[model samples]
Target: MTGKTHIVGGIAASLAYAQIGNHDPLIMLGAGIIGALLPDICHGGSKIGRKLPLLSKLINMLFGHRTLTHSLLFLVIVAWLLNSFIPNEAVKAGILAGMVSHYLLDMATKNGIKLLFPIQMTVRFPLTTKTGSKVESIVFSLLTLVSFYYGFESLGYYL
Candidate 1:
């Protein structure tokens, strides 16, 4: 999935989570955006990679794309770090939700992701689509609709 798709997915996931958890939607929105782009830091061409070139380069050099950063181990480490550093429970939950959404979206792509890392095991949905393809666009659209639904619902705008 592209950066835009990931962003929308994050928004949708975060808003849904916030609504379910009775947390603040606005705060989650920002954290979700950050988390969605976090794993892509391994690819120099990705949005987060472009923003943090030095860190992206170093991570890419050390772990390569969809390796360590995309792994469950990375999520565990992030959870630990967030628990230790971030006092806001909503922010931590939102970020983790967004990252999970990112993983799910990427898993739908043909290239797949190394969910286990170090183990060299790739994980993906049974049916995968090409990044930036029409199918991905459809997924993006669905996520957009979901985002709008959750966004409005959170604000007390039911429809």
Candidate 2:
């Protein structure tokens, strides 16, 4: 999936989670965006990676794309760190939700992801699509619609 797709997925995931948990949607929005793009830091060409080139290069060199960052180990460490550092429940939950959405979206791609890591096992959905392809565009559209729906729903707008 592309960065835009991940971003929309993050928004949709975060809003849905916020609504379900009765959290503040506003707080979740920004955190969700950050978390969604965090996993792609291993790819130097990613949105977050472009912003932090040196760190991106280092991570990519050390672990390669979709290796360490996309793994459960990274999620565990991030969860621990967020729990320790972030006092806002909404922010933490939003970030984690967004990251999970990222994992799910990437898993739908043909390249898949190393969810288990160290084990070298690739995890993906039964159906997959090429990154940035027409199928991905449709997925992006669906996520956008979901985001809009959740966005309004979280704001107490029932339409």
Candidate 3:
């Protein structure tokens, strides 16, 4: 998943969390952005991957993509970490949002994501899309459109 996809995916996750968590949309959006990219921290091909390519590659090589990062166990730990030290609910929300978004986008790929990792379960949508596929471009585009629309709506409501 590219940065664009991560951003859109994050927005969607954040939006869902915002709705579910009943937090401010902006705060949730930030959370979503973080959530979207958090998983790839362990992948070398990803944006955050290059900075720590060796660690990312090592993780990917050892566990494979989506195995560890996509797991609920990891998410729970992440949430706990946020809740314990992050001070604000909004920041915690972002971490969770980013975590979920990371999982969801990987699910969109042809390889799919093992969201239930270590359990040997593969989680993917029925539709198989190549990572960075044309379909992903559209998905990201739509996410952007929806995000912008929502942003404008939010501005109107707030202003």
TM-score for all predictions?
A: 0.97, 0.96, 0.85
What lDDT does each candidate get?
0.93, 0.92, 0.77
Quality of model 1 by C-alpha lDDT = 0.93
Q: CA shift at 48, candidate 2, in angstroms? A: 0.3
lDDT of 3: 0.77
Q: Identify the candidate with maximal lDDT.
A: 1
lDDT of 2: 0.92
Residue range 54-94, candidate 2, lDDT tens digits = 99999999989998999899999999999999899999998
Per-residue CA lDDT of model 3 for 1-159, tens digit only, reads 677788887887676666557678888787778777778867777777887888898888888877887789789878888877888787788678777777777777778777777888888888878877788888888878877766655554356
Which 10-residue span in candidate 3 carries the lowest summed lDDT?
150-159
Which scores better on lDDT, 2 or 3?
2
Number of the candidate with higher TM-score, 2 or 3: 2
Candidate 1 similarity to native, TM-score: 0.97
Please identify model 3 stretches exceeding 4 Å from their true place: 19-22, 156-158
Per-residue alpha-carbon lDDT of candidate 1 for residues 36-138, written as tens digits (9 for 90 to 100):
9899999999999999999999999999999899999999999999999999988998899889999999999988999998999899999999999999999
